[model samples]
Target: MSEKRIEELRRQIQYYRDAYYQENQSLISDYDYDLLERELKSLELAHGVAEGSPTVLVGGKASEVFAPVKHLTPMMSLDNAFSEEEFLAWSQRAGGGPFLCEPKIDGLALSITYENGVLVKAATRGDGETGEDVTQNVLTIQGVPHRLSGSNHPAVIEIRGEVYFPLKAFEKLNADLVAAGKPPFANPRNSASGSLRQKDPAVTASRPLRMLVHGFGSFEGLNTQSEVYQLLESWGLPTTKQFAVAQDATSAYKFITQLSQKRHDLEHEIDGVVVKVDELSRQRELGATSRAPRWAIAYKYPPEQVNTKLLDIKVSIGRTGRATPFAVLAPVKVAGSEVEFATLHNQDQVRAKGILIGDTVVLRKAGDVIPEILGPVVALRNGSEREFVMPTHCPECSFELAPAQEGDVDLRCPNAESCPAQLRERIAYIGSRAALDIEALGYVSATALTQPLEPSQPPVQSEADLFDLTLEKLLPIRAYVLDPDTGLPKHDADGNPKIVDFFRKKDGSPAEVALKLLANLEEAKTRELWKILTSLSIRHVGPVAARALCNEFGSIEKILQASEDELSQVDGVGPTLASSIKDWYQESWHQRIIERWKASGVQLEIPDFAGPVLTDGIFSGMTIVVTGSMQSMTREDAEAKIIAQGGKASSSVSKKTSFVVAGPGAGSKLAKAEELGIEVIDEATFIARLAS
Candidate 1:
């Protein structure tokens, strides 16, 4: 009788789940669904049902566009509360004297699983049981660490987070979409999900997606949620800064109400407050239904909306050569900030909305996020409204504009390296305080230096070009000067302001100014490899990644010689970025520029590091192959530690390999080690050897 009932309950539950998650149609009320799940759970417990029962799993169906992967632990949703009475009742029922409240971000759910501190898998929360693999896309997020910060952590852990697009980035994305002739995203949540699930990881990388860890899926060491939060901070993971410990039901309600009112002040979207038991033991004791943990509840708030007009559309050319479209709105306050410019996204968005230059448009801004042009006010549109069209040539460089690659919505300037606008930006970036710190030169001087040269002269297009510059040539680039005593324009014979470009005085002698710039250039040559690499303006190579590359290779020449596969072996330098780096070095123009820059005395080599050089250690002069995931640290960390101990950490196992440290998931490398008769050791023994 119980078996029959269980089977019947399963069928009904599956039907409801399919309707809610797959079809977006609710066949029953939330209360009725909860009752059904409760009945199923009771029957399962009484009859000793299998562990695979839906009573313990998640709801959403996995997307089929990518490879399907199973979750190590199910990512369950939270139960909802529509009012204070429902929430207080939940607290009383769960024995909740104290609880933790966090803002429930309205974004896509993601799971990042790390083994030995190295990020191994990133998947979306598909069905509670399965998800799609998006490891490459997750790597692109700067907030998601490639390797955990520090050591002495669990052997493995899975962090669950909400991947979101900040309001500002969302608005910018929409504007670019409008300018690219694409449809703009409706909201931050939708934009984040769509961007993260993109088939091309590079496309996803280009989007601004950030993650905030609020919980974990499967963790080996943590005992409580508070401990988890602290560990997350240590691991360099972002979390809600406004969480509070509510002592009782009333305090919890008060906190929620206060947060709800301040929601618009946040830079990202949040729909509700997630109240959960602080103690992991208490949470486990409370247990959970298949849909949500009994210890947690979401108190939802009403959505905030506003309306405004998009006055005009404009495009801006960025240094990377991507042509971005933005909206100029008639100033009106929205979401607590002054309203001026909102993003249309791209050209397709303009076409999608059928937006015209003079059309009254509906604009929305959630929180402190950048406002977006939702759509045109079709009812108010007059035929006088003009349609927007992307130009075939770049507005700044007049270079023929087209998509940088196939399947791209963005139209890019083909002459990024040589375009005056791009060059000026690049030069300024190279000279910025964050990079080489060339304090003597700034965007003002950099732009003046980039003015068109004689027909026969080499173009002054990059920061590297400045190294080849001489006092004789740059002295003539002029700026208006004022007399020091009078604070007025220094007069020439004709009563015009004296021109002083570079070091040039009214007398046309540029010697003093040229000396200052030259001295700055000399100082820049020795500014560490990481800074130099950052100043180079290589695509996708930011400060962190630049430092990683320099740490691995130690010299620009070595990095240039590295093949994509070899570059990919570096932690955080994935296939796409590796390909970009390798391809950049292969370009003939880049080759010429690098060679010229070197000849001009701009230092491109990393100085020998100062540290205790290990000698006569057991690992000294040894070639070791590290395969599989280590139990105590990341592969990159292990490799680094190995090198620190005076051993060479290699990618593959060969006959000449001195040792192979094999750990969990060891496969091909282990086989190779066996085939080659190389000495192999487990992680424990490997750690011991390193310690010795």
Candidate 2:
């Protein structure tokens, strides 16, 4: 068993190493790969070490894309220590004491040779012994000086450094790429590596690349590691200002801790801190391994980016019938969570990313954000990988799919009224806090009511059927407890589709959820008219627009009677939105939804608006924009209040905006408000105004 596992680990590590070094891609996170390597080493120690085991090797060989150059002094990789224990162990082995610590920049390592104070050749760190020539590409980087500044420079000094893409510039570059309908670079490290190896120097120059000297390939006239950095800086080469000399292991660990806290604040991304023995004599005395020097070790932090296989690409029909393509990924842990799916956005996004089913893709999950597929590891693709072709018909109803407007990238299902998927999504949305606020009638219950198990009729067919679901209809119903995000049925440990007697107790009586849902649905019928309008799934009509429409027309009858021009005259309703509302009202099925809901005791009118009161309106003709989270009320409630007081609740801040309600965590909108010199008030002030 040990021998078999060792073989498997060897192959896996080799594959990942090749992906990282030769292909300019990372198939696994640094921390994960380290664990794998440690496991492989453990197993090999128990069993005999196999020939060509990765534990004895340095890195993958140079790729064929560039000319390979042998280094005068081989560039070795640093051993990694993931925890304090491991770092202490390494420190003890290396004869302990003062160490030089610097942030381990996540970038491509390079070795540049300067002959007689003039720049000559530059290469990538390939296989420790030989590296790929990237002289012209390296020269394109802005800050790299062509010639050394001081006359006291060595005859031939091999300066080792890292070429990195700035985090800020990386975001802009990715946004620009997406805007141009091109595949975005995966992460800063791979992006920097790929950029530095471009065939065209102009292409390399176009990218925002910077280099910071870290070490030297050939030691010449440098006594201490600190002196080496000072010498490099004197020669006009960029070196890290974040480096420090620590007295001992504990102090070094403190340095690592401090740097990790401010890692994101730095211009470049740092995986960890590199700890090296300070004195050159001690470093030489400690000797080196074939793969790494014994004097240096990198302490890696937990990774946010990982690579996972794209098992499939599936389209989910949303409440508004927008068909969004999402990737079904092989489960992988990233940023403290297990990620099984990542959104591809639309068909155009899938194409732009150049991803294929069965290909390994880079997955990134930052703090509290949705996991994103940066792009695919094209180097890992085999001929077996398949291109994802979006279906021309809706998977739920077999309705022909088309773009809502010409030249729009997203495709939509027009069977909004009857499609099971759309009905389920819309029903779930109606229960959302943004709509009718029916807490018990969530996605699971929505699915159970709309798409029950085989041989059982669905209790609710559409939003119209929601108010009419009886105990008899619900008690007998059984449905699959689907994945809320994908709406696909979940399976059990035995691999069969999991089914639940959704609205029933085991004894065939109505369940607690069923009772709660019924009560919630009954209560939802008496909600405010704007909430009812928002629950209809009308395109472009959110709470704000619904409130405006309700305030202007007072009733559903008046809204249906109103002309497009008349509807457009409402504060929040523009011409396009007005046309959409009119078009929605003209549909026969939509008319049935309104009539059936009205028949079921649902309120569809604003209360007590017998005469024009615009002159007496508290905020008449005012366009107020609310930004960020308020402690007293939600943005929706705030907007609703604005509409009730006869003010236009606008989403965008502009010169025409009357005032801006700013709260905690307000971002660009508040900035824009300040930039436009618009009147801005805090949540307290806005609440006072509303009360008055």
Candidate 3:
């Protein structure tokens, strides 16, 4: 193959890949794409073509389950330069001029193809050179546009983007999983990958996965870095918001530094910055290494690590009763803050890293957010180092720990009702915004309030006791009271509290203020049954689940008296949650607490739903699916409309779907709707239907 022909073929193949992967609309069918690829391979074989050959693979094989294929161009890993010194060295080697510094998204890399402005194919990075054809999955991502907006468009375009799960979505997903008696995912990266690799495209579509275009895999007409990014944005593709034209490496480093500080506030995760030569001509002039383009380099942020001693390893019981181990370390500075503890993740992680008590471990904070133990210093281990063991019983309640059922790794405490740790967590959760929505009783305060006094001399043993305690009793000498005016604590000349600090108030005086606060709490008991029940902190019951229970049972007293079978009958309340709730209410101590609260004049009334209910509508009893970008309103707003019209807004498209509301760049959901023979309506049609 001639050099010109090889370049043309490479460009065409790249364009097709982008169409299929980055864009949801396919201009050419799979057959045509395959034919083009085969022809390119044939041409390369015919001519001993080495430079710019379409046959130069970059991605890996598609599994048989996925149909594995290797990349023509080896998808080489970037040599990360973390500091200015390292970047300067890289730039010196490349003889740098102007560069483009872009945000480094923490996501899975993918390649996409576009033909005549229509999306056609999408694939993962896989092994870099060859990747699984994930066109179906890519279509589900919110950022990939189905069709370009402008009439004049590129003949073929290939783009690359990082697909990620947003932090909010990840947290919500994990919360839902925990509510269902399943383990939560550790982080968004793993969740994103797992969601994308699902066999069912519909399943992947349900996850809040987003895509951000970062670079061009192949392009026919685009010449400059700015032009490519602008073209992507014009096509409704999500591109990295942070991009700057730097005249030199120093400017590029400055841009990177500014972005690094703002990284923590971004909705999506970013690890570092990517600096590329701005001018396409200059990029070509400074051309390729055998691995990476000489005009481009990734400048990663230094790993924020701190040296801290492992004071102890303790097991924490989660909302699901699963016990997770974490390390309590001596306070050490890392990532601009003092960190005294880090998650051990799991037994597997602990064993893998050979972490032990008394071992000096390296704690790393990524993006100045999550702190995790890197590993122990093997050479520094001494005779004092002790192997940590997971307890067979709950440390709080002494209940036997049971192995999680199939598909779970953690052990769980069976004693849900009597476990102080479980009860405390439950109460804290209830006080959370997602639960009882209690504004006054925060997690820390709730924890302190719920804690039983000394076993030998029990104080405030029941909920009624809380109402009887004086303000002096509740206040601790060290607790600071926020001054309503300044939002800070009021201090005396010596920097002590003007009024004794809550902690200090306990110094041999009856807590009159605590008693008054207890009285206020007693008055609030009548506020709503849902608030009362939720605030009690039953296991596996979140705010939604609590509301569901309230909707089923009329009041808190009714829910408390309900049997496991009766509680399980409520919609969204499963056997596990039912058992947990039942066990909690059935306990003598818990019953005593409730009785005391009742005696203290705490009312348990159900709050009325404020929203108007649709008695009759086309949407009533219908399940609707919303997909892609809506111009008139946000996706959330559209979903709210569906719910308001008495329709059930489902995350994924299924056979039961009544209709699919699609918008610009509607992806996998649209395809799934077509496959399932479900009716698909555009934003206008959806609005019209809702009106009708």
Candidate 4:
């Protein structure tokens, strides 16, 4: 079990690493990725470690498009500390000291070499040992000096620095890209990386790129890291003025805290603070690890909150027909990603947050979690800001909207089966990784099939019609790629909707996406019964409940026939889920969907060799709730381990919950557990309990 989990973690980490380093894309935020790697490192320490484990790896392989250059000295990555305790622990390990603390610039690392006071070559920090030679592109950056000043430099020196896009420039660049009908880059770091790696030096030169010296590889003259920076500045190279030599760990931490407070004021993004032993002799004495220097560690700040104009408040219809209000904001960067829309949950939440249209709102995004509207900057509001009004009718279908139950905060559209917006979301959900995992049937494909721009009749009106689609049916499909959160068409600079012939080329031939989707639909029919159940969009019935139901009943027919009491008897399927499943199946439209899917040859029975049933184990009948950031494992992995031990991993805290595993940053759930007098344990205690 440990081996299986370790392999899974390794695979996940490798995928993200490759995306960030090779593809110049950030699939997840830095903090979330760090948590995953931390979990993997912890797991490897407990269970045997692998040779190629990401925990022991540094950066990624150099791109084949560029010539590889071996570094004079390896450019290792830095281990991260998310909390002060962790930072202090590193300081203790380094034998306490006056340390140099500098902002950990969120950018691409570059190693520039100078021979006889003349800038010669620049390369990326690819896999630490070898890098992609990008001398031409690096020379294009404004702050990178072509030649040293005053000529007192070493005969040969390798300067390590970060190549970054200034915040203002990044914003303008994104605007320019949007104006040119091109997709904007995700963040400044990715934009900088993509610009630096451009094959054409002219293209790189056109971008607003800058550099900041952070360290050096083969500088014989420098006695300390701080001296290296001063020397770099003297040589007409750019260096950060933010660096300081702190007398102790407390002072170092103080510096980090102060920097974090004004992080947004900086010209370039700084995700964390790098604290290192100031003296070169001590750095060597402390030595190094395979992946990072033991003398240095990065203290990462929590997710950032930024202010953006709340252009308007709009409602988005979900797969469950729930009408959720979201804030349409002037796009802004937050937590290393561009955030334009943030969910306000429902009407009550909008009122609670005191957010008004045209007001400056505080937006917070943590890791890859969805952006959240914390509240309005009430002080910044002018007379122009207006209150949001919830619509009486469904925006998509023009059907009357009402709460599912009396006094409920949320409103829902009753036209669930045929509402284009709801159907689009449901079809897209079916293709999500948690459901059927159909790669080709994404949000764009879902919208094209259900709500085409050149609409006569859409190719698909319901998910039931999804499998029946043919090339002829899909050939005429055209749609604008609508923003999933706002349901508004994306437009070009001239304010025209960007219509895509989703299933065909401009020349009218069937496109690759169309053929792939058809093949995927056929393949989806044979997926495990759990996936089919999950794809049904049944209220409150997700992967866990679906798997439990399939394991107990084996077939969808048996589940359909089962009473609510019988359904609730399955592990992880409580009365609420059972009722929801029962209510869902009783709808005529849902029944038709099932019948159509059955006729379409979808396997609705559990496979014969469906792995272990997991009916009994150490934690049998116990409902465990794990919350916050666990140091030893991710919440998902923790839940999986709990389930493997015959426990029901629940999301909420209630009277029936056996206990709660609380870690750092545990919030409302921990409070609820304490209020309910339920037993609570730390992650370490919980892990030990699992072992016992």
lDDT of 2 by residue, 568-593 (tens): 99876889988888888888888888
What's the true lDDT of residue 111 in model 1?
Answer: 89
lDDT of 3 by residue, 1-692 (tens): 36577668778877755533333223333334445666676677876657644345443334455755444344454545756898999988877867878987767777787789888877777646677777888888886788877667777766787888886687677656655654344445546766787789999999989988876765556678988788778777888767888888888888988887556546776768888877787776886745457778877665454456898888877655778788888877656677767777667566655667997776667542457875564444677989799898887789888865766677898776557666656655544554444454554444455552332122333444654555545554333343321123357779985433332243555455444445555556675565566667666665445655765666777787888888888755779999888878777877877787778766665556443223345788888888876778767567756755667667789999999987654556786898899998888998888788
Go through the candidates in order and give the clash count of each: 29, 0, 64, 0
**Top-TM-score candidate index:** 2
In model 2, which regions exceed 4 Å deviation? Answer: 1-19, 25-32, 43-76, 81-104, 113-118, 147-159, 165-191, 198-303, 454-456, 526-530, 543-574, 603-692
**TM value for model 3:** 0.49
Structural similarity to truth (TM-score) of each candidate: 0.43, 0.74, 0.49, 0.55
Candidate 4 structure quality by residue, lDDT tens digits, 362-453: 57675545797755544444699887999999999999999988998889998888788899999999988768989999888888888886
TM-score of 4: 0.55
Listed per candidate, the RMSD to the true structure in angstroms reads 18.9, 6.6, 16.0, 20.4
Give the lDDT of residue 414 in candidate 3: 77
Between candidates 1 and 3, the TM-score winner? 3
Q: Which stretches of candidate 4 lie over 4 Å from their true place?
A: 1-303, 607-647, 653-692
TM-score, cand. 1: 0.43
Q: Name the candidate that leads on lDDT.
A: 2
Candidate achieving higher lDDT, 1 or 4: 4
- Full ranking by lDDT: 2, 4, 1, 3
> Model 3: runs farther than 4 Å from truth?
1-270, 282-311, 317-322, 330-336, 345-349, 352-354, 357-370, 374-386, 396-400, 403-408, 412-458, 462-516, 560-566, 607-692
Better of 2 and 4 by TM-score: 2
Off by over 4 Å in 1: 1-311, 329-345, 351-354, 360-380, 452-459, 470-475, 478-519, 609-692
